[model samples]
Target chain A: MVAKRIIPCLDVDAGRVVKGIQFQHLKDAGDPVQQARRYRDEGADELVFLDITASVEKRKTLVEMVQKVARTLDIPFTVGGGIRTLDDARAILSSGADKISVNTAAVQRPEFIAELADMFGTQCVVLAIDAKRRLGRGNRRAETGERAANVESDIAREASPTGDPEVWFEVYTYGGRRPTGRDALAWAAEAERLGAGELLVTSIDRDGTETGYDVDLLAALAARVNLPIIASGGCGRPEHIYEAFVRGRADAALAASIFHFHRYPIPVVKRFLRQRGIEVRP
Target chain B: MMTRILILDYGVGNLFSLMSAIQREGAEPLIRQEIPPDPCFDGLILPGVGHFTPVSERLRRMRSAIDEVIERGTPILGVCLGMQVLFDRSEEGPGQGLGLIPGAVVRLPDSVKIPHMGWNRLHLVRSNPLLHGVPQGAWVYFVHSFYPQPEDESVVLARAEHGVSFPAVVGRDRIFGTQFHPEKSGEAGSLMLKNFLRLCRG
Candidate 1:
C-alpha cells in the first residue's frame, strides 16, 4: 500500500516566501530556496510553491526561484500560479520542477488540461481549487451590518446564497478574491472528468486559522471524487494530519503556517502518524 | 584503451544535457542514432525521452545493432524511455519491446497522476553492484508517464512512489535500467553513471 503524503506549501511573491492570514495582509516568510531545503531536511513528503502574485502581475513563472529551489532540495515539488500555456508548463518542468499545478488557466481553457497530460503526462499537472462555504440567510444580517450596502451587493454577486446564510462556501480565484459562484464539489468532479491527475482542495474559511482541517468538507469532496484529494487549510496539530488521512480520507495533507513557523517538524509528524498505524515513509 | 560509452540516440531524448553531464564526469560518450553493428564501444548507454511507442519503434529498426552489442557482454544502462524499451511490451502505444527484460509498461492510474515527475526518494529493495555507494533513501529526479512493471521482481533494485512504487532502478548482470534520469539528477545522478562506468571497467 502507498503511504499518505505530508506536504508543506510556500507562497512566493517577487522571489520571496510570503504567508498571510486567509490570503490577506501578506508578509514575507523567507527566501524560497532556503525554506525548501529546510522542509526537505525535516522530512516533508513533497513541497508546493505557489507564485501567488504571478497571475495578477501577468508573468510566465518565477523561473530563477524554481531553479534555485530545485537545485537545493531533492524532494518532489509542484509549482503553481500563472501557468497559462503549454510553453509555460514546459518551461517550469525543464527548470527542474517535478509537477506544475494549474488553477485559473486550466479552468479558462479545459483543453489545456488534456494537452498538458498528453504532452507531459497527467501526473505532472495538479488542479488547485479555493473553496468557501456560501453565505446563508442567518448570516445576512451580520453581513449587512458588517459591510456597506454596495460592498454587500458585490459579495452577493460573487457568492451563492445557501438556504441558511451561515452555511455556504463559495469558489474564489485570483488568489481567493474573485468569486466564481461555483460549488466546490461540482467543480472538483468536473476537473476529474477533464483528466486532472490530482486535486488540491483548500477551504478559504479555514485557511490560516490553524484550528484544524475542514474535515466535513474534505470527506464530502473525497467521497464524490475518484482523483486523489490533497486536503489544505488549518493543519495546526500533529493529530490533524492523521485525522485528515483516516477520517477525511485525503490522500495528502498540506499546511503552511504551522510548518513555516516551525511549530512541528515533518519527521516528528510522520513518526506520530506511523505510531497511529498509518503507513508513512520514514 | 579508455572505456567509451555509446549513448544510443533516436532524436527523441534530451541528449545535449545528458552528454554534457557524461563529459563532466570525465567519461567518453558517443551519441549515435544507429549503433555500429560490430559493437565497438566498451559499454552502451541508451538514453531516451518522449513517448515509448515511437522510441520502441526506433529500437526495432536498430534491432541488429542493439543485439550485437548486448551479446558482446558489454554493460548497458537504460534511462527513462530507454528503460521502458527494455521491457517485453508496452501499453504506451502499439506494443512490443526489445524483450531484454521481462515486463510491460502501463499507464499510471488517474488517482496517482500520469507523469510521476519530480525528485522522489528511492527505497532500496535488493543489492546490486551498479548501485554501489548509492544510499537506500537517496533522492533522484524523475519525469515520465509510463513505468516499467518488471515481471520478475527480483531484478528490482530501488522503488519510489507516486501512488505505488513500480521500479525506480533494476539490474540483471550487465544490463540495467533506471526509470529516473541519472544524467540530470545532479551529484547523485552523476555518481550513478560513474558506478556504471566502473562496472564496465570491471
Candidate 2:
C-alpha cells in the first residue's frame, strides 16, 4: 500500500526560508538547505519550497538555491511560486527539483498546464490552487471571460456524479490576494483534464490559523477529481494532519508553521498518525 | 579502484539527483549524450523521468551501442522510464523498447490515482545482491503513471501495489531496473544505490 505523505513546506523568500501568516508578514525561519536537510532527517516524506518572492532579480537566486538543496537532500522536493513560463519551470526542474508547481499562471491561462504537461509530462506538473470559501450565496458572483466559458463547458462535459456542490470555494490568485470569482472545485476538475498530475489545494481562510485543515474544501475537491490532492494550510497538530487524511481525504498533508517552529517534529507526527492506523512512511 | 558509472542523458528530465546520489555512493558518475562504442565504465544508469515513447525512441537510436555495453557484462541499472525502456514496448506511446527484459509497459489501473506519486513499500519476492541489506517491506518514492509488466516472471525480484501489483524491481543477469526513483527514496533508496555500486564493484 502507498503510505500517506507528510510534507513540510518551506515558504522561501529571496533564497531564505520564511514563515508567513495568511501569506503576509513574512518572518525569517532559517537557511533553506539546512531546513531541508533537517526535515528529511526527521523523516519528512517530501518537501515543497515555494519561492514567495520569485522576482525577476531573484530568479537566479532561487535556481541556485534549488541546486544547493538538490545536492544536499536526497528526498524529492518541489519548487513553486512565480513559475509563469516554461523557462521558469525548466530552470528550477533542471536544477534538481523533482516537481514544478504553478498557481496564478495556470489559472490565468489554462493552456499553460497543457504545455507544461506536454513538455515535462503531467507527473511533474502540480497545480496549486489557493482557495477561500465564499462567505454567502450573495458573495458568489459569476465568473467572466474565457475562464467562465471553460468552466461551464467543463462542467457540462463531465458533470459530477454527486451532483452540484452544496457550498462553493472561490479561487484566489496572486498568492491569495486576488479573487478570480471562479469555483475552486470546477477549476480543479479542469486542471486534471488539462494534464495536471496533482492538485495542491490550500485554504486561505484557515491558513496559519492552526484551527485545522479545511476538510470541507478538501473533501469537495477530492470528490470532483481523481488526481492526488495535497491538503495545505491550517495544520497545527498531528491530529489535524490525521483529520486532513481521513475527513479531508487528502493523499498528503503539507504543513509549515508546526514543523518550522519545532512545535511537533515530523517523526512525532508520523508516530501519532501511525498509531491512529494511518500508513505513514517511517 | 573507484567505480566509474556512466549516466545516459537522452534529453529527459533532470539528472542531478541521480548523479549526486551516485556521487554520494562514492562512484564517479559520467553524464554523456551517447554511449561509447566500447564500455569504459563499470556501470551504466538510465535515469527516470520522461515520456515512455520519446525516451524509448532515443534509446532505440543507440541500440547497437547499448547492446555492446551489455555484451561486456557492464552492470546497467534503469530507473522509472529507464526501467520501462528495458521492456519491448509501452502503452504511453509508439516506440520500441530495448527489450533487454521481456515485457511491456502498461498504464496503471484507473481505480487509483493516475500518477502513483508518493512513498510506497516494496515487497521483496526473492533475495538478490541488488537489494542486499534492504528490508522486505521498505518504503520508496515513486512518480509515474505506467509500470512495466515483464513477460518473464522470474525477472521480477520485487513487487509494489498501485491499483495493481506491479514489478518494482526487475533483474536478469547483469541488467537491473527499478520502477521507483531510488535516488529520491531516502535511506532505503540510498542503501539500494550502495548495493548497486557494490554490484558494479564486481
A46-158 per-residue lDDT for model 1 (tens digits) = 78988877444434438777767665555568988878888888777767676789877765566788888767656677889888876552343342222234334544442
Model 2 chain A poorest 10 in a row by lDDT = A157-166
Whole-model lDDT per candidate = 0.76, 0.89
TM-score to true structure, per model = 0.76, 0.96
Angstrom error of the Cα, residue A30, model 2: value is 0.3
Clash number for candidate 1: 13
* Local accuracy of candidate 2 as per-residue lDDT tens digits, B48-137: 877888888899899998888888888999999898899999999998999999989999998998799999999999889999989989
**In candidate 2, how many clashes are counted?**
0
Model 1 chain A scores worst on lDDT over the 10 consecutive residues at A141-150
